[model samples]
Target: MDTVETLGKYEIKRTLGRGAMGVVYEGWDPSIQRHVAIKTVPLTDVDDPETQEQIARFRREAQAAGRLTHENIVPVYDYGETANVAYIVMEYVEGPTLDSLMKNQERFGLPEILRIMKDLLAGLEFSHERGVVHRDIKPANLMLTSNDRAKSRVKIADFGIARIESSSMTQAGTMIGTPTYMSPEQFMAETVDSRTDIYSSGVLLYQLLTGERPYEGGLSAIMHKVLHTEPLWPSQLSVTSPPALDAVVKKAMAKRPNERFATAAAFSEALIAAASASAAVVSPPPEDATIIESRRPVAGPVAQPVSVPVATPPKRSMTPILAGVVVVLLAGAGGAFFLLRPSADVPRPTPSPTVTTPAPIPAPAPAPVAKPEPVPPATVAPVPVVPRNEAVAPAAKPAVSPAMISDMFAQITATQRCAFIGGSVGNNSEAVLTGIAGPGARDDIRQTIASHAVPGTMQWNVANADTVFCPALTLLQSIAPPFGSADPVLALTLADNRTTLHDGDHIRPRLTMPNFVGYLRVDYIAHDGTVQHLYPQVADSSGAVADKVHEFVPGQKVSLGDPSAGQPGWEVAPPFGTDMIIAVASSRPLFTRPRSTNVETAATYLRDLDAAVHAVRDGGGTLVGNALLVDALAK
Candidate 1:
């Protein structure tokens, strides 16, 4: 076989790499005047079934990768086939593969490892939600755009064996994918799903953390270990690895898909929580001090008292002059008691003492006044009087005025249509901004808010929106609830792990309350601005309850919209755009009774929810919330 000069309009410059199936070339796109990587598979004897299947798979790769558009994914620009070869042009990245870097003994710090994992998981999450599973998720398939740890960016490649939900190119009994990174189900030649990629990602994460694979050896040996044995914990293998991450790895690589994290987002959240826990351990706060874990600095005046030790003065003998002075002070104190005594006609003002004394010397009594009213000695002697001229100081001023914050939010809303920005004052005297905005708008929004607010007094709970047209997300942001900075007590995920669904598609919401033991209320905000209560159906006599974990009993995980469980799922409809699913977990029931209407305007429902959340907070009950956004596309 001879190397060709060009494939379609792409002019081949040099061979980049070659594999058993095809060769990748560094090509130039004449029209775009940019470099592109052209991957070509040679076509021989098209009538042969093996050749025909290979060509089908080659085209499938193009279709699968073409459907995805994400920053972390290598996008396919075009796909074409000549008489003797088929090629796909992709965005050319200039860096080594993760496998090559690992082989070269690249040492990745915890932060770098986390960054890589986040990018990988984000790309996987997006692909999984769209019903595409990259059957081969190995270090070899992950490309980096830079060698510098801080600047390196991960892009997933090689979708030749990817299985799209709507495609039946791969059969269940077929064994495909790299052996070392294959999931247990994949090795067993069983039907694979998103969890399959999760298992492979777990392998990659393990390698990144411990500098070794969980199972290493020949095909049969690796299979046996993956099927029946547990690997050493990452913390054991790597001294710097946090022990908390061990459980995350175990869950991700569980033999059964049911035991794994349901979605990539869930897995990422768990990893972040573990990382945070590790960070807290490394830098513990001072004793007798309140620790407020917040995403932003708390604004306002803070009083930090400093203690100073004073030396005792040298002993001195008392003289006749000192004795005379003591007598004078005793006479003055007696006169003050009479003048400061409360009268029956006037109410007594509360005393505010400035200093505390361990003991007091007895003073000489003055001559008795004429018809003196008897007063309690305990009250008169201990209470210190404040001057009538001095008034109590007013509370500290906020970092930024409320009007200024409102004006900033208005400006942000005007420029960023997909953004929903809201502001409030926190208990710690900081100005808190909570909402969702697209990636492109986040920097501008942050800068705008920073200009009007104080540096240390501003906190944020604003999450970056994955898509630009998220109306339901904007609604959730507008109704921003005060969620604490601690790990979320509850989680809400779509059953399919999808953020988008086509019209007529059934939507299922899954709620997990790992540590929460209380009442649960789930609500659905449709694209059309209507809200519906999914849990605690109007006919049900009892409210939804999430039981806590006891000995041998796991925490609650409820799945809605399952017909086998006798629950109906919400179906996608017209007025397609973004929708939201919200789950509120509380120690007590949010509402006293079920909702009367089947569906109501989002404004009405959100108002009721706000009242319920307030009531729960006022009652001293625990409250936490989680929400997911879904895009309803027209089929």
Candidate 2:
């Protein structure tokens, strides 16, 4: 493992590079006498539980890239795993990476840029058609070289994290891609297809033209811009570009996948066309010219010009010449038909018929009017209407004040009120609810208002908490057991609201729970069906639990892998799937016993345990504020 002279049948010359996951070495295949690059993981990680998971993904990358065959894609020859290391052999591409090229300030010409992009897209098209998505498509992953004739050659490298359609390698809520070049869908943690690559390619094209990224800043800023901002045009970035190029960039980088080009092939065709059109219109066009044609016939013979000059002393009227010239011009042109056409061409008016005078007649007598029937009066009743969240006005006037409404909410069971936000009925009967926890929370509050307040007056705006709060709420519901009340609502806020975790990454969530919680427990469900109790072990006999309840922490921050729990903080492990975190709170001690097993091979506690912990159980008076362990965990 220490700078070996050879790996299998290949002779290692020197190390190419090293990344967090593995190492790349420049080697030679003795069998075919061809230069090959060997990629392998460190011998030390083959034993670590977390590293084993990454090695599996590393092998998956080999499988995904090995199945692909393209001129522009890096070719994989062989892959194998030893007792202590995993290695992949591929063709050694000769040239600097696109990242290196960009750093050298090597600006590419329009034609060269087009060619490189077309080849890159062609490779992506091949992979996508085969149901493989190269999630990470950035300058660092692209290899570039210029031939002796100045023609650029591009090869896409490092399909180490590519997603295969049939693989199921990644989880549903988990995101995997570089943030800078990621698509809007990737940022939203949505399932992606080939269009994601198209978005990244658009970013690359913009960078190629202007020598800068379209969106630049921190991860949050980039995400906000990607989701809600439109990038500047190439022409606006000081690049002398044509309108067609701007159109291509705008369409290719559209936030929605459907709005972008459907396939990489389509993206390539548009890119080629835009680049060519820009090249053709580099020069200015010529000015306009005018010509006048004379329609007079030359039938008359030439007249003698003798003494006519002597008669110039007599003034000539120029108005007649002008009128004659106008007439001649109109005749020669199409206007002559309207000015000199015969009467047959014009529409003729029809003649009216003659009328005879009528004879005198006698007048008739007027008729008498009948009496109207008497109408009966009837009584009408008003319909009682309730104000819901639908923006409709309530028929009945709201009787409760803002303080009264808040008090009524306080009376509801904490479970029922988990998703409720404090709301008030205005003097105009409009109800505005703030601090709504999630999207579903709006409906809960609306139902509560309809039951207790005037109908058609409640309006809850969830826009403020939606972006960050909804995702965690949805995640909690998806993984935890069903609960009765929304109370004991647990809001887990990640240090940056980032859900994506990697090897050696720590996840320290700031948790917000109800004030009545006396005891809390946290657990983790990994992708491999193993459940890890992340906090509050049942074996801890210390009085720390009682002390924690005595002190009410509004926003308690703790790492997932707290050393006190005898485990590393929320470090990412292998078999990458949608890993979940569960938290339970109760007024009394949990009845079930906690299990401690190997960190990597622990069996799931909820798998077949028919106890109260597996599902929500009514704790009766034992549970505080009507929320049981399941209700608390549901947060």
Candidate 3:
């Protein structure tokens, strides 16, 4: 086996990265007097014929990547097998791994991501020509080094799982790559070619643009989604994603492998085009007026006319002037007859038979010279309603002060974690039950919105940024009676209670509570499909109870108040406790077929939960309480 400390003459300095195949180590090579990346695979990895075959496959990948000596491709220097280990030596580059970059930095602008995308494409093209496919392309396997953060050069790394056309390694039906970024074909164990890598790069690119991963759920859940579900478009995350980028991303991640880019080079080219198209959408840079002025010849300013010579006033002939006035008066009267009269020019008056004028034997009027004719007046159009995200009519007044803006954001974020998780999945307006917007997430989303908005108000551009800020500022503006800015907390509390819920409200995704003590499920009546999931709930859980649903299953923790089959934590908790109560009209959904495995049922159950939510929102009056109170009154 190739030892770690010194691989032949190279002294291993430290571990660079580790994987199932081998460990990458930073090593000192005396011959080159420079640091080099050395990978050592111990014989234990391929102790038998099976591993040995895989190692042979590794050699083919190394060769394919080795031939790709581009700046973005990790260049290989040597490859060999010792005992049960196979080792690869390559040039050492000083930069953070793409994985690290992503982990540290949540997102990058389109321009920055495109630069990395292009570099990756060129390297991929170099490998694909030799019929090599880097099936496991993820952020961790990429490296970046640069002076400018936006223009950092990216290098593709870890081609250990590279698939070559002739290689007889990596058997079918065996899941190998990261499921989050894996393409459907890889999940199916189908023959993966270059297109598979393209799909993965698309996923990677999406992640870089949106700090969140494209798919959600556990490993198995992700695999199922990758194999069956379609990802939401990047534009959904934020409107900032250019339409062109969205198209390219969609094409690259198309469910049908054939629909994806044919090659990495093709993907890169498409990316380039998308970026160019996005740039074209922006206005051209302003031209310098100085240049325009220089081009124009200014003849020295015209001299002002001094009273050089005033012409003598001309005298008019009295008889002709008087006759001319009479002629003008007659012409004006004659013109008014046709101009204001409702003859042919205007519609006839409704009242008829009042009087009829005799037709005059008039001159032909030069036979009425025919002209092209005038166009009809255009009808007035109603103005369109401005979208909530778009700027409304210009602000009546300047924005609130920065201090007020900060206070508003802090107010909402302060109580971010102050959310409820009393119901099961589909609770809290039918969102995923058990979502823990825990204080952390609540604080994060609130702060994120404020961070974008406060500074956003400083500019007139930025879509929806000002809108979001306006409403939030308005909420803050109404916090207290006129002069309550001095005490921001009371104002915020007042605003929180009075303001209608907007999308930005700190309505955290409810996480399942640890203790749902003393809750008893009174009953549930659910159909095959309905948004109203749980209703008329009661629980024994004793504490500062939010609603009756919490009292139903005191020990059973629920994420949201809503409950359904696909609900994560709502399943029959393995062995149902005799003491625990989960009352339901029908446990199984009425319909056998669902929209998407369980979406119909999820929506159905969310509806059932409306009663509990209403009770909480309006007043803590259970359906049972109303019936009992009414019965007492009747008696």
Clashing residue pairs for model 1: 298-457, 299-457
Cα-lDDT of candidate 2: 0.49
- What would the per-residue lDDT of candidate 1 be over residues 270-324, giving only the tens digit for each residue? 9988877873223211222111111111111001001111111111111101000
TM-scores of all predicted structures:
0.45, 0.45, 0.47
The ten-residue window of minimal lDDT in model 2 covers 324-333
**Most accurate candidate by TM-score:** 3
The better-scoring model by lDDT among 1 and 3 is: 1
Model 2 lDDT tens row, 360-470:
123122110101112221111222322221222222333434443333332221122223223334564453433224335545544544443322344433222222222
Question: Per lDDT, what order, best first?
Answer: 1, 2, 3
Ranking by TM-score: 3, 2, 1
State the displacement of the C-alpha of residue 91, model 3, in Å, after optimal TM-score superposition.
Answer: 1.3
1 versus 2: better lDDT goes to: 1
